[model samples]
Target chain A: MKKSDIIKLLILIIAVSLNVKTMKSMHANQAEINPDRAKISGKPVASFHKFWADVKWMMFIQHMGSIDLTTESNSKDLYQEAKDILDLDPGFYKVYELSALMLSAKTPDLAIDLLKRGQETHQNKNDWRLYSMAGNIRHQETFFNKKVNKREKLREAIGFYRLALKKPGVMPVLEKTYIKTRAQEAHEANNDVPLVIAELLEWDKYVNTKMAGSEYGMEGEGGDMFLSLEENTKKDILSLIQRVKREHQNNLAGKKTSKAMLASLFKGIHTCNSCYNEYGAGHKFCTDCSKPVKVYGICPNSQCRKTHSNGKFCEHCGTNVKPKKKKK
Target chain B: MDETFAIASSLWKRLLGVRVVYFLTICAVSLIAITNMYDILMIGESRALMVDTGMMLTTIAAMLTVISLAFDIPKELQSGIASVLLAKPLGRTHYLMGKLIGVSWVGIFITSLISIGFVVIYSMSHGAPPAGLVKALFLIVISVIPMASIVLFFSSFLNEAVAATISTVFIWVGYSLASLNGVTLFDLSLFSMGAEAFYNYEIPPSYLLKGVVSALLTAISIVCVTSFIFNKRDLQ
Candidate 1:
């Protein structure tokens, strides 16, 4: 045989020989290391949780292994996993973020518990994200939950938001005006009129959507009370939502033929005589023209001009006519 | 009958004659099996990485099988092996199918051995995986065909190395689609689906069916088109 062909043969033989050796080595190692075999020899693999010291590593491996896509409430594996992660090292805050968000959609209480534990454990760290998250949770639960006192939850949420603001570099103004008004002195110093109507309407939608379900069942003591509050709240909020939506359209049209456009869409649009722009039904100012808007038609006697009624009953002399109820 | 048998036998001989591919397969499976044995030390920790890594190793062995097909078929035609087969009573279509069948046997054998190694090692850590997980792996095995058919389809017109490269590229294209927002084509991603289902995510039946069925339909279409085209070609 030529030298090259002879060498090729040698290489092939050597490679096959090495492959066999490697397989043998692998088998020997498996015999020594296989969990089943080890169990027979009095060395069962230690249970999963015993390695709490390696919680970070454990969580990392567990998450790496599976991110359950199915949104099943029964799968509390993520919660247990998150708790373990926090228990071993309270600093794994990322776990709380993911775990809390996923858990909250199903179980708000556990979600709050996780965030609370995280907050207490990492208090020294002064993490604003934690405080912001806690506040948002309480705020959402105020609407989502009815078993709790709504006013107290709202107050707690406000407190959390305040704490978050005091933690340095917080911009409370970006979120909502109420927090901003409470937070900044300069906000009050300005001549800016607060957009209270718009804010109230949004809160109305928030309460309506959550309470539309049996948030806190109607069977208990405060359940009926909560339902009454929600009913009245919704009634007030719905009227506000309609009013704001109208004013919003009128402002966009500005002072130019806004009433004509508004009259085409809605029948009872309150137009500004000063600027031909429309306002909400119960407004006090021609918001566009800066003139007095609420020409109160609130009088019971027709002969008094001292209490001016726009066009309806006289505030000083005519009988007040309540709006007729629409048949459903 | 004698001529067809002779043709298939010749094709098998040429594939078996390539000592290097055989050695590579053995080496790949051994490496995966051994590394998995070592991961057993992690004990009660997630046995997922073992399955995930093994799935990757199986893909490597499948790739080697595919790359060999890229060169082997064209090299056979260039070296007058095709003429010898065509000289028989065997038709052009049978000759090509015989070659494909030979390639499939090699691919299935090597991939199966590698998959077994993965199962063995994973079993050592956490006993037998669920039947559904095994089913996903089997689907991965089936997904390999659509890719191999692509290489075969390309080999009908392109150079051997180029055919293999394009086939590998096609597999990667199916894979990268996973990063895009919605339909990640998990079932079509073959072994990746197994790795994800076993080690990463809970794959639902609807998703599995959609992916695997689409991939199988694709392979059947490609194989048919390539065979018909090859049958019509006039060899130089």
Candidate 2:
């Protein structure tokens, strides 16, 4: 090789060696992500905030586009990063809003707590726009979580909005309108009246009655919402309950929902190979994830020549059976 | 001005056949595929995730576009295209500005196409595009201007591989710096800041004014410096 070629080759070797060393250092640094030190608060400085943002971004990178129960553990690091950001700079409303939105699904309580912290800290900092966000998150949680104690969350939301209304510059109209809308939402989200009423009926069967000669009252639905009635009201309630039970018995006997009929309606339907979240028979795609559903009768591999959806796999080539995509 | 436009048109035409354009197009389509891979609405603020992911991908596309264009500059110099252009009455600054605008055009076009694809895929279920998606697209488009300019500046002195590498490092560093909460030097923040501010609805008039100014001034400054360097350099 010429002198120039030799020099170029040497430079390449040095560059490669340095890159390998850098890669090793990066790996070593990555291994230092100890969850134990996550709680250590940094000083309220620009560098501290950047460090926290980096930590949060790391967590987000690992668990991007997922906020299901599976991603909850990753949310812990995000939780710490959020705390660090807030502890360093309480007026960073964007971080609070982002954390609240992300953590609200898997860990609503943590999400709620973060927003509450934001509200108090931001109030101290004299920034009142957070009131809208705090209230909105509460409502959003209630809307998303099927098992949410709607009354409690709604009340907390209202409390935030009320405090926001008291903030010097907040318009009365907007606050009042937000409260009204949220209150209406609370009513709707209280698990539909019929669903709650059905639970109350189930409670009447299993609670407030003697069991095996024990005159003990059991905890009922609606928490402590029910109470002892007056004499006349008690008599009327007893009669109404007896009549409703009779009607329920009659309806139970009269209703005709055949298992075979249901099977017929559900014929050829299948569950999603992934998630299994919303099953439908004969579905071309997984109803939830929109991926082509694996089927018992057809090969999934596009290269497989087998055309039938038979047994577990294609008999000719043994490709896993999946639903065939309709040709456009 | 006409000459500059001619140079820009020629540069843009050349870029049409480059691998970066295809890479960015695939990146956009890959985003849709990735979105399809998940039940995207599974998260809190599903809409927010959609917007944020799309914006970040566009920024990445912008970065790669800048690198691609910057690398092209060195290749042009080696191939005598720079010398041939200089043989004309064209000023160095005008040539630099043309290259800047051409790369930006390519960058913004890729970003906007990808943004539109993301919007369509995300909003197809809802029958309408999500709120702030258009604004995010505009921010990404704006952010690419400075990114392309920075890469062009690097290309003025460095060879292809070095220009591409340095451009990527600088852009990433700028993005990281911009993401810092209290960083007063907003000029380096790029479009990521625009994405954050607009998506979060934290944008005041001052926020937008500052972001626009930062992007414009950075691009102009980088172009000026690149032109000065190109004029001073002795060509073979």
Candidate 3:
């Protein structure tokens, strides 16, 4: 070939190569850079995954340049970028909702993370909905990670359930009951016996009774019935109560040696059960009377709502109840 | 008077007749109308006013240069008018150079008028065009140099009507394709890749490579082919 023809061929080759290289670099960068992962593990896993994902996402953006996402050609990249965002902040609720709706199983972690993060930040009714969604994902993970000693994972899930309980707004009573029950199981498995028993009793008295006719009640189909806690924590609580009663009998019989033991027993049981039930069981019960608390009004369902010296039934809901008053 | 200047004056008078004025008026009106529409719709970025004005200058310059050059040599050849013009005391190169210079001057005038009108109207409707408007206008004017040469080369042999009409349409289409790197083809290939990857991993298209490469190729082709065609063609 002549020198001029060779030069022309070289130019064409160079142009094609450059275009290909540009596209390849973009793809490589997108794959490498993701948003920073929620530093779930140690520093190395957090930093390495985050750095790698971020670099990939940045390169993808650079490769894409200024594309309008509304166009059909640009929509794919837009969706991918959104997935990357969810990967970085899995607790980002909106991102999870969008990714789940759009990409589904391809970005399940993102969807779960989006809901988790939404629960963490907003603390609103919507945030509770997201929290419940995250709980569903955690439930699935719990089932899947059966072989993986998931103590820490369960703890994290418990945190989200607690957030859902604290969130303002009306939730389906069954859903709220379900969240409280799961939280009780998490606490019991983690060695919170008193909390486990207290939550069991609370659920027995309130949720189980209210849900008696519904699918959410302990007697209903798939009703947890606090069965999981009954098998483990109930035994523990019974032993503790027997020990406390024996120590108290010794104190009443003028055995001064067991007086301190009785006081310690009472304090330990009260502290353990209160902390465990309130924080771990996911119930916002009153500290004084140990009744379920309500927002915006004194508990109308409590016996304290009546004008009598010691009413036996709640004036509002007409149920047998105690009359002691307590503040949140 | 200098022979070059005298030749330029006569050529200018011939080219900028009533029809040329009408064409320029239509171009100016269209430009203002488009700018008004852009302003009313608010369909662009913060620098839109400046960019639009710059685009208007470039469009007018391109239209004037291509129309004038495509007609200059062809009209002279068709009317048996070259003999009368060639009998004058000017070299062939000088006559050609003078005609190009006159055309360029008219192009510059049209560009300036449209650019100024855009800025003034934009200022009245919105605020002043950005501070970079002048620099943008200068860049646009400089960019049209290759376009002017293209029409001039085509005019040397083709008839005025045919050269003007064909080259105008062709140059616009070529510029668009070259700038965007055959967007239609790129999108068609993307579709064949299947929907999942297309929706999840596709990158946005950029024109840095397409614009530079296509412009270079078109410029070289025009220069080489124009030289070859001009040298062999009868100048009747």
Candidate 4:
């Protein structure tokens, strides 16, 4: 062999060694950047870890597409798929979310566990959707399974929402959810309608403001699905607001409510003092109870008849307002 | 270096003109149609499934192009084509380097074409392909560098069939091999962005820069080793 070739071989050996060292350090750096690297276990077929995860995810979605979720049982296969997907790619946020939601129907504990795993391994620590879903699941579990403590589950769900609210870029729906759940807890413990209504109104105002600011915000549906929260969160809040308003209106009207309180709460609607039934304009009595109700807000002057304020005179026209005598 | 580049350019043009290249491109585009039809079946995950399938298909095509070098090199040597070229001013190292660049170019070309198809299909159905997907495709193209060099290195000593098999296996099992024994050499999974692309997460520019640099370094090192081996082998 030529002496030049011998020197070249020596240099090659040195170069390859140095290259190997550099690669090792590079691998270390990569590991540092990806801390959740430990989630992937077992020898993957063909090292297509991400590819196989995709295939698994496709299968999952395909199965989901095929089955009617209402009829389908929470089988062990679902849990296995969740484990397989999470194991294959811990960074798969959608897999965590959609699968956990599916699992939460019957296996809520597993769903919460999966969500917790997602929170730990997800790159974005500030992600609120996972926490929100976990809270939704937890809150739901209390209703279906009587075995669990209702108060404890409610507290945990509220805690999850609280944590979610602290994170940046949290959706307004979370705050609304937190309020609604807290109201539920309050109402369950004490049957306090006013306190729940007040909390619901606060959340409703916040969500409505957010909705007003965005072009995509949906106005609420009426009380068709009173059992379930609506898909459009703004709609859900609006629906809740309307429901609570009715409950509060009834509660306030049933009591010895001041005229100012009735005016502020009902806003242009008149209610019977005796029966708490609503009355139309020009009606001297409640239609339901036939009880005499003095419509005091109308101007007494025949020349300038208009709705008047609680003051002695009409605000729309300078005419004296008087309490008319009720019919015997 | 000029001769090497000239050889590379010619080989690139020649490979692009091949009938198989056209067939592969057609296959890749049609595969997109098949996945598009899978939209109803994938439920909410249609976009993700399409992206993953597209990336996997692109990787397979690029790897095939790279593996074809094994056959090309050995066939040239057996047919006295390499001898005729070596009889001139062309050095064996230059020849190998040219083949590496040329084959890698072909792989990259095919990958780019398929990527365009993927992006277009994805946009039509899913509004727009995410930025991360484009980055993933770019990384796959960059990874073909090391892959081409590995095939070249193996073909320098081993028979065409053995070289092709080993190269294919090495790339296929890259993630497992890396995790199994910390073997970073020839680990192709580093360039895989299948998950990131599917999730539509942003990939930092620094990561891409690192990938490009790493691919170049791996390619150069393997090429150096290949040249050394090829220099000692008797042409006859």
What DockQ number belongs to candidate 4?
0.45
Poorest lDDT segment (10 consecutive residues) of candidate 1 chain B: B178-187
Measured with C-alpha atoms, the lDDT of residue B59 in candidate 3 is 61
B116-176: candidate 3 lDDT, tens digit per residue: 7666765776676554354334333433444555676678778888888876765554334
**Better-scoring candidate (TM-score), 2 or 3:** 2
Question: Compared with the true structure, what per-residue lDDT tens digits does model 2 show for residues A72-154?
Answer: 78677677767765653454456777777777667767776787776665223334456666776776766788787777777
TM-score of each: 0.42, 0.47, 0.37, 0.73
lDDT per residue as tens, model 4, A1-328: 7775676567666656665665666566556556565567666454466667777878887676676753335445676787898787788777888888777877788888888888887574558788888899989987898988887898899888776765665675566678778767766666555665645544544344444543112222333211222346534543443444445556553232334334444455666766456666557877866889966556767877666656766777766565567899
Tens-place lDDT per residue, model 4, B136-202, is 8998888888889889998888888999999888777764655565676656666776676666566
Q: Which has the higher lDDT value, candidate number 2 or candidate number 4?
A: 4
DockQ by candidate, in order: 0.02, 0.02, 0.04, 0.45
| Weakest lDDT window of 10 consecutive positions for candidate 4 chain A | A218-227
TM-score-better candidate, 1 vs 3: 1
TM-score, chain B, each candidate? 0.76, 0.85, 0.64, 0.95
C-alpha lDDT (0 to 100) for residue B209 of candidate 4: 78
Better model by DockQ: candidate 2 vs candidate 3: 3
The deviation in Å at residue A327 for candidate 1 is: 64
- Rank order (by TM-score, best first): 4, 2, 1, 3
In model 3, the Cα lDDT at residue B44 comes to 31
For candidate 4, what is the recovered fraction of reference interface contacts?
0.31
Q: What is the TM-score of chain B in candidate 3?
A: 0.64
Write down the DockQ of candidate 3: 0.04
Candidate 4 residue pairs that clash? none
